[model samples]
Target: MEFDYVIVGGGSAGATLAARLSEDPGLSVCLIEAGGRGDGILVRIPAGAVAMLPGYGKINNWAFHTVPQPGLNGRRGYQPRGRALGGSSAINAMLYVRGQRQDYDGWADLGCEGWDWDSVLPWFRRAEGHEDGADAFHGGDGPLQVSHQKAPRPITRAFIAAGQELQLREREDFNTGDNEGIGLFQVTQFHDPARNGERCSAAAAYLHPVMGQRANLTVLTGARAQRILLEGRRATGVEIRRGRRVQQIRARREVILACGAFGSPQLLQLSGIGRPEDITPHGIEMRHELSGVGRNLQDHLDFILAWKTRDTDNFGIGLRGTGQLLRHLARWRRDGRSMAATPFAEGAAFFRSTPQVDRPDLQLHLVIAMVDDHARRLHLGHGYSCHVCVLRPHSRGQVSLASGDPLADPLIDPAYLSDRRDLDLLIAGARQARRLMLGAPLAPYRDRELHGMHDDMTDAEWERHIRARADTIYHPVGTCRMGVDEGAVVDPQLRVHGLQGLRVVDASVMPTLISGNTNAPTIMIAERAAAMILAAARGEDECAGHQAARAS
Candidate 1:
């Protein structure tokens, strides 16, 4: 097969780039995805995203488990990467957070030029159409449709009320470059009850809308990229396995890898680009010995504290009983929307764990209603859970190949809370959670029905409970980190460092994780990546260039 560009992974980045590049009608672009087509009901429904977790890897999720982390009591963590068309965004909570200004400035501050917020804000605005309209920090017109919930649950509103009284500062918009907030979240929904029906999936936001119209774009579903076909020193194409047979596709312009963090590094290692010593033992020929190809992994560790509630009220909206589930589903199926997330999470706070930090290091994720573990664990009568995550963890891990075969799962060591400060912040967040519970406003609403955590929550109890049950808040980045630093895999242009005709445009390229959810930022990266690749193909000055991007 031949194309002007061959993109591995029809994920968020791959889908966006394929749609943008093929707009010319002159270039041929092929997008390869490893999972079955995203056709289930849970994927499209915003509230249903949690329900999709279990069924995802069974069909659409890559279902990759991480290597046991010495940091987490030698227990292997479950790292679920989307195998569907929209990638993880298709499976994520769909919170549209762009992170902090410092995150991007840090990229520019450190060798990656053209990556500051000033340069990439246009792309963010270009990809997002915030329902409220344009602002100094937001765009009103873009491919991705970002909207707010029409009818928010009362608990979410109460959460905001609590934040206001606590003096955390309540702002309607978090995307306005300022990090402070206990604001209602603006979700990626279309409208009217906001049941994730019209929410922008990567496929809906980028792929499905532009597929057949562009004859130049060929999207291959369930096609796993085995390796980058490198002819001598340059990447020429990719070898993909479609069903049972291995097929080769050549690229004329570039072979871009948008395989997220896990797949990108795994594919790179399989293609012989990494530490020569590690690659040699896997029976794979060594190419460029980029020692940092699979290092610097990062993730947001969140502690979920769930408590049972008395007097069911609205926290049991979806699960008031089997009776309520039927009623909500009925309304959802008939009208395509419902009063959910409305009165959305009352408030969220970006707080600094330590006084020394310039900005907030911990993000308080508050949910009013009693939802089970992603609704995964059986709902225990009526209960609500709140999630507290350390926004920017200091621990850095790595993603490496355990085997040379692309079919084998990559070795992912997120090194969660490897930094003691992270644990301290989590403990601090627990303290804050207790404070919120004790706040006069929540005293009536929060009965502390579950976990026996109502009265006298102590520091020792918070620390012990937090360490025992803390899990991911779902932001994983920096594996194939983009920078002009030592062994950086890609430059600010998202192009592979020291490699020709190759680029990685996904969460994998983030030098560090942002302060919020990665869904919006990941999409923003794709939008910028598409524009840069298109500019480069047109012989124009692309934002990211090789000569100026070499690691110092």
Candidate 2:
């Protein structure tokens, strides 16, 4: 089949492109996703991911496990990437944060033109339909429906109190231009605009509610893109597998890969476009020797120590519990409100690892309910937990071919904490977590031990404990980094360095992982990349939505 554009993955980036490109009606877009539709019971419920991440209800997660990291005390990690529509954003805890401006400026500094925070600000605004209405730094009518928590959890209130005691300024809206304080984030909520509202993801924002009637857009789920079809030097389309059949799609315009950080790099390697040395052993012919295709992989690694408390009412009925479930079905319980939509989580604030900087280097995610060892073995035993993940990680890793077969598992090395700096920062986060627990506001919840924490533990014991339990905060990026350097897989325009008719527009292309959760930034990248792709397709000067349009 031939298409104007054959998007390889129907995740965050693909959904945006399909919606935007098909707006012209002149452009035909085919989005192929390996997973099924995004309408699963788990995918729709915003706070229902505790059920989805563990166990096997495949709505959008790829459920890929990583090779044991030598740095992580030789322990393997399970990486749940989005495999369905809307991608990981569909399955993630929807915290809508546009990371520090310096994160983007750092990209431009790396020679990726037009990617500075200033240049991409409009695109960020363009993708947001903020619930707080709009401000000079936000957009009101964009496709994405972003809003604050509807029923901010009591624990969330406690978090702000703790921050207050620490003199950390409370930011009602973290999406604003500056992120120099601690506060609740304005999430991408398609349902409600505040408090304990239902979680809204990108698929909910851009694609859902619009998928049923768009004729120019064709969404194909369970379609695994095997490789990009190359006619000479240009990418013509993609070859995919659906069920027992293999289909070929020819693209007249371009092929955009939005399989996220993991799948994107895996697809690039399977298509023979990754590092040459990594490809040769797999017995594949190299189409392009992009050394950085799966390099510079990064994510926030963290582990939260919980203390059992007398608060058994932490779990709510809107999303869980047998009794509340009945009341939920009995009526429109929220009465069309988000803040009181059954308390999901209450504790979240950013704090600096050190007092050197005003903005937080580590973020604290405090789930009122007990979450232990991968959200498994629920502490129905009445406990509260707070997760502190480093906002920035210095360690790097990659995804490479483990075998020649496309179906074979790729070698994923997240190399978490391999850098001594990363180890130190994480230790700082732990000490910070301890400080918060020991702080005045949380003293009431301190009836039990937190992580068996004691002042008597030596530095070596802390490092050992840190190495044993550290896991990803689920933000992964930089596999197909955007830069002008030789190792760069994509240019600042998100164009593959040496490939034609091909571009990677997911988290994979991030030169550095943003300071918070990666979903918002991934969507931001798609919005910006869409404009860039549209501009390049028209041969227009880098003006207006051309990504570089706002560059000073």
Error of 1 at 2 (Å): 0.4
lDDT for model 2 comes to 0.74
Off by over 4 Å in 1: 55-57, 192-197, 311-320, 339-347, 354-356, 368-375, 452-460, 543-552
The residue-level lDDT of candidate 1 at 180 comes to 71
Give the Å shift of residue 355 in candidate 2: 3.4
Weakest lDDT window of 10 consecutive positions for candidate 1: 543-552
Model 1: per-residue lDDT, tens digit, 1-552?
Answer: 999999888877888888888887878999998876565666776655555555443546776777776666676777767788888867766677888888888888878888887766777777776777877677776777787665566566676777678777877787866777687777776553443445477777778877778789898988888999998779999999988999999999899999988889889999999888768889998887787787888898777666666645444634455566556566666675553223224356776665687987778766655644344455556555677888878899888888887798889888887888788778887777667655666555666655556466676777666656666666788889988878798988888888899899888899888888888888888877877787787787864432222210
Top-scoring candidate (TM-score): 2
